[model samples]
Target: MPKARAITIHRHFIEPGTDWNTEDFNFSDVLSAQGSSGDALSITPNFRAGAAPENAVGGGNLVDIFNAAAEWWERAILDDFDLTLNFGWAPLGGGTLAVHSLVAQEGTPNRETEGTIRFDNDGSSLWFLDPTPDQNEEYQTFTETTTTQLGGGDINIGRVYTDPVGDAIGRFDLLSLAKHEIGHALGLSRANRSFRAENMDFDIDVQAPRPFPGTEIPTRNGAHLTLNTSLMFPFFVTGERKLQSGIDILANAEISEFNNINLNPVHVPEPTSTPLILSLAMGVGTFVKRKSLKRQSGL
Candidate 1:
């Protein structure tokens, strides 16, 4: 087993007053290959039946949704690396929809090699797995009365949609959640050194007399992006399905560049072109262990 530094927990939350819009955004259209000859990125998912069943929700395949999420990144990042992600279900406290724990490299606190993702199975909120896209746009808006570690509040998880333009009001989209978690695994987080360095550069480039328009201020304890539509945003709305915006791809590209890996940049948008979307309501937090731990087998 490989020794790893302390686990860094990235939690996802459900916020109120956020609703899905009627925009048809395909990740493939925005993240198409830029003719890079680098090898494709490979992600191996290990579904574990620990604490709770891996696919507790009925009527949909959790593994399939996870793979779909992985594919989204694979298309954008062409680096040649094999990453293993352990998936499981557990009671991740309240207000949290899911969590991503990165296994840092031994003796190197800033470098991450693998990760684990656990979904909320504590019966706090209803879960739906919409395997296909639904065009009906009859969804309700919600509000958060109280906030918890994960994002505790009132929500209506009635339906699920694979894409962002469907009608899945009151329901959390599993596909979208998976994509957000995987972004953390791929180094789109401020917890990683590369991400932090890139963010600092972004700020400097836009400050004072610079020509850049905005700054890269991280929210949620420096773990998530603030005031942006990046998939790595901490707050998740009930029915909204967000794809990887240009900021997300650029963030990951910085990580790849740090690792000396080349990525396809054909469709990656300029950082200035990144749009600012509605800011959702929720409390964002990250749990960082001060001590190191032995890496688990097969993780």
Candidate 2:
């Protein structure tokens, strides 16, 4: 039998309105590749200094929204893995949620700690650059922002568009934005050929489906993932009132599978030379016995 594997999550929510998104944004279901669920990678609900609280529209608190998002992650991933999410209210100096940690902000002055800010998606299309240009070399970036606004008579959480004219807009619920940022934290800056190298965040200037010379490649678990329904998909919320459906399902499955593999790894046998050692030991013992008998007989 293989040993059981376990995991624990420790997360601190980025102060509300922190500018974590850059050239592009990444969104994912809450579960890890294994079916574990936790708030280890979630953000706080209340707007911090300078953040516009007038934009949040959902009728719930941070705990409720986070729990709902965590459930979604749990459903997406499979069972058999340990997952936990810890809630925290500590502040952070702006950093990357999906690519790497926070870094210095240039070009655009860092916005107020918690208020409306602009996203830079102009260079995001470059993420798809291919070594060899071809007919299939195309790229696009999906970017948006979340802020508070007055809607239907009260303050609400709403998404502000960052795409250029005629570019598609992605509408996300507040919880959805947190989920997206979590994907970035997991090192998904842009979609790539395989899940093992999936960089779904917006930090890079590369795009997906580039002209790489190879057939479809499988993930570390030997499974091939299609663009649609992949946890690494760039877009999160769409239209109004619709959280990305079936996210928890994927997160749960991935987390579970990862844990199973870790808990039960394949074992390779030792070398085939062990029996030779035992045979040599028996030959030495027999020669000793014969010598002792000859000495007894005075031969």
Candidate 3:
């Protein structure tokens, strides 16, 4: 029998066209949220002491975005196990945003047990912490535009539907960052043999059109995808809020399938549907029903 091992992967901040670098990331344990079904995957978040403050931003709290990030993944994967992750704030050297540590059995198909995700809190970068607004309010909301030089051209990276609208200039999107880190914590990494094998299987299964003949795809630091605009890309552009793309979702599904875990790729929500999904998760959608029942005759 093979023993389970822990692997750590670091996410670095890179300027366009620059080579990827390495750094550290952290996590802790505290709150837990269950999915709609018993078989749905659940994530438990633990915050470290005096790490990052629970500052209020927009009309919501800072931790709300992290919770939202967790929920986003939970809705996409349907597994019977709960993943406990520790999160914290730390100085992760230069051009590093976060780090992820995962524990899994060493085999052709690894089964993940738990993981940790730490964000850089070294004060070297500015972060935009804002709650995603409801879908109905998206029309009137706006975000300040910012661009990064990519492919010898300037590309807009700003995102909308964030509270304190128009204030995202020159800052990193915390929600997108959290989602990316969570993706790593969920076993989406090239460093894991299972992930590598599963990714190949995914490409074969989809008959993925390749620009070149290769058994392995191109990646950044052997952990992030470089061929596509994926959330797990090596560089996170400033003012950009990247959501999980179809490829990203399918890649995660492949790894989950390798571990015998069920996945609901079709149920993955778009950005506009996030607020509604989270509301249902927190039972806010059922509030009126619960209140009405309470007002009815006691039984």
TM-scores of all models? 0.55, 0.31, 0.56
Candidate 1 overall Cα lDDT vs. reference?
Answer: 0.45
Candidate 3 residue lDDT tens string, 167-276: 45555667777877777766565455566665553441222221111223234445565533456666665555555543454455455442322222322123332232
Candidate models: Cα lDDT each: 0.45, 0.25, 0.45
lDDT of 1 by residue, 1-299 (tens): 54221222222222222221213111110110011022255555766633323433424556667766666666566544556676656565556777766554222324446666666667663455655422112222211121122122221111122222223545566667787777777765444565566565343112322111242333443456553344666766665555565445445544534232222222322223323223334334321111112222331
List the candidate 1 regions with Cα displacement exceeding 4 Å: 1-39, 50-58, 106-111, 133-167, 189-191, 196-220, 256-299
Model 2 alpha-carbon drift over 4 Å, by segment: 1-6, 15-52, 75-171, 186-231, 236-299
Candidate 3 ranges with C-alpha deviation above 4 Å: 1-39, 53-62, 104-109, 132-164, 196-218, 258-299
Sort by TM-score, best first. Answer: 3, 1, 2
Better of 1 and 2 by TM-score: 1
Instruction: Residues 1-299, candidate 2: write the lDDT tens digits.
Output: 54332222223334544554433322222211111023122222322222223333323344444445444333332223232233322222232111222121111111111111121112221111112211111111121112111111111111122221111123233344444433333222222122333323211212222211121222221122222233334343332122222222222223222221111111222322322122111222211000000111111
